[model samples]
Target chain A: MMKISMPRWFYQLASPRWFYNFTSKLLPWFGIATLVFLCVGLVWGLVFAPADYQQGNSFRIIYIHVPSSILAQSCYMLMAVAGAIGLIWKMKMAHIIAQACAPIGASIAVMSLATGAIWGKPTWGAWWVWDARLTAMLVLLFLYIGVIALHAAFENKAGADKASAILSLVGLVNIPIIKYSVEWWNTLHQSATFTVTEKPAMPPEMWIPLLIMVLGFYCFFAVILMGRARVELLEREKRSDWVKQLILVNWTQ
Target chain B: MSFFLAALKRELLLVFRHRSDIINPLAFFLMVAVLFPLGVSPDPSFLSEVASGVIWVAALLACLLSVDGIFRSDYQDGSLEQMLISAEPLWMLVTAKVITHWLVSGFFLALISPLVAMMFFLPEPAYPALIISLLLGTPTLSLMGAIGSALTVGLRKGGVLISLLVLPLYIPVLIFGAGTVQAGAMGLPIQGYLALLAAILVFSLMLAPIAIVAALKISIRS
Candidate 1:
């Protein structure tokens, strides 16, 4: 059993050629799935879902806000983990994946902040609040932008990668602080939901769409990341024989 | 211990030798604090109420303003390269630089804050807490700002980029610093607030040296 597993693991999956081939196969499926679920979930959320008695029609923003907020945090974590891998393994591809995650993560963070603020206007009586979670999410956006800017700011790519990786690691320490800041300090922010001890505040009729939208966002993220990474790879590896063979050979075939 | 002291002394000499440059950030701090009261409201009650916040905000900005110069001077002059090649660990040198920077920027901010505190018509009783808060808070600002300066050391237009990079990380310090004065105004025991501010200072102390050193490695790699 160990031998069988080892052979499969030792196969060329870590190679860029294999990874790119694999991602290409996976992209179309994710793209279609993302569109299908996004359309279904949006219709269900905006049309079929019940309006909150308190927030009225504005509650519909939750479908966009929740998924993007979750994605914003997760993308940062994912990119940081990739950066860690790059640091440890000296894997150039891992750094590229981490780099690709920045703009995408920043965009999601912007979406979350925008939707959260829009939702707040109806419920919280203000467009902005210095609440723990909102402020934390805003910081997350800035962190993403910082990493992207640092990446572009350096003339040497390797220098930029290492710098950004370290910065992301530092920012990762703040994630827990951001999560518990409200509880730890006497701040004007709400407590967490979706904990093990309590049922979700919303019914399944509402939560199901949120779950679907999250899935759709994940799929969309995968599609875009692959598209971006492929372009990056083509530019970085233009002189490599495998890339030349893959494109030139495949084009003629 | 001597290494740290020596590094601190060297840094102070370097910064003080350029006394004219040191005053620019201080002036910016004063100007920014004054601008807020002018733009917002002239009402004494209102100015007094927002005075701590206004002062803290300006000090934070001032600290950020001086951050790029922290390592940029040495890095540009190639002293950072020599320091990196030294027998001492780079983290110690980074910490010393940060400490010296805090001494110059944050400590000076504390000393002058009483005078600026008066400009905003801050309550007499609240003066001690305001100065103390800036004193406690500015070291953390220097440490965190070192991380930003380290990250952006070799970049063009690094000053603005450093501010953008550093401001978000500055939020916790701002929150607790402002809380200290706010608590004082409410006649509440400010010890807890000060303790929280101290906790942040300690936390940054433990973490920032490594980050600054790591960022220096990246910055110097190019």
Candidate 2:
């Protein structure tokens, strides 16, 4: 029944140096966890789980499709929040993290689009239908590309960072609009099957593996993002003595 | 409001002084509309059916063509910076400039819309809907475009960059604007789409100036 106060250093962890060191230690753990969970999730979902009565084998794509779609949207939300923090606190670390997240987010979006198309060919009897959900997802992908391009388009890093941050904030208008485009219009796309409160339509056996895949994706995102941030930190803080000392110490170690 | 009027007057004078800038986008709009009939089925009914989409797309392109003009000159002359430091709030000035922008480019696009409608054989009644939709829609374009313009003010070759930034954001306006005309063409109630378009215009009118001011500050600083 005892409680202990955490050290000030715990809160100071927002410092890139602290984060780089902490995340360096955690990266390998997340990488291993990601790999272990990914293998288990893929095998369990693809091999062990029973096929759906309607979709049959094609339903298997859901394991990848749904996870990628979820990550794509969640990554945007993450970047927007990071951008907001960067704007508010003027945190360089937040900006770096936001910049790092864009490509990973865009690739995830592309995968969602590709997987949706693949799943569509079998399920909807068309490769693409211009459905609200599909179109919105496609638009989300474009928004990601737009943010990435805006970031790259400028020579001044600050300009790129701020511009991309604003674009990310503005494009968020589309996310809600996209999510509801189906409901608001009489579109071909079905309503959201995944809800927080209600049980998913798929059984626990299937959903559990899917859940693992989602966790694995998150771990993978962390691993890559940390790697990118470490590189960014070193690059941005290259002139600092601490970086040089850290490099020298690492060499000596 | 007076500032808005003054900015609009200044913008119109600039457009008149450099009239050649107007022709390219208007030509681009015409060419794009012309291509639809060449690319798609030339059947009258089909063209008429999709006329709103064609006109709306062309209008989007035309507006995009002019967005760079909104801030590029001011940025080049450093007037944007001066405005930022002046007693007049930059947002009001930017809003005025955007209003002027719509008055020239968007207004031109609206005037020529009936011709584009004729190309698609749109019925007489749909013509008014086309003008009404653009009247409500084009100001939103200028407002939104002002944000893009402010963002890309200092960049070389900002024309393409501005389009990429603004076009995705233009989707809702396009949807409701075209939906109004489409509804009119289909003999359905156009009230809903028109109301939505008007609401969007109002919303963008309120918010875009502030965003433009922020962007202009950032642009001027860098």
| Cα shift from native, residue A30, model 2 (Å) | 2.1
Error of 1 at A251 (Å): 3.1
- lDDT for B173 in candidate 1 is 77
lDDT by candidate, in order shown: 0.84, 0.84
- Predicted structure 1: lDDT: 0.84
Candidate 2, CAPRI quality class derived from DockQ: medium
List, residue by residue over A1-253, the lDDT tens digit for candidate 2: 8966657774466588888878878988999999999999999999999999988899899889888988898999989888877876687888898999899999999999999899999999999997878878878888888898888888988878887888788777556744553335447865564779988877899899999999999998888888988898899899988899999998999
- Runs of candidate 2 with Cα error greater than 4 angstroms are A1-13, A178-186, B1-4, B21-24
Superposed Cα deviation of residue A47, candidate 1 (Å): 3.1
Model 1 stretches with alpha carbons more than 4 Å out: A1-14, A124-126, A178-193
lDDT by residue (tens digit), candidate 1, A87-122: 876877778888899999999999999998888887
For candidate 1, give the lDDT of residue A232.
80
For residues B53-104, could you state the per-residue lDDT of candidate 1 as single tens digits? 8889999999998888888878898989888888888887888888878887
Model 2 agreement with the true structure over B1-222: per-residue lDDT tens digits: 787678677877888888777777788889999999999889999999889999999999888887888788777888777878988767767767887788777888899889999989997788889999998899988888888888888788788888888887888888888888988887788888888788878877887777788778878887
Clashing pairs in 2: none
TM-score of each: 0.92, 0.93
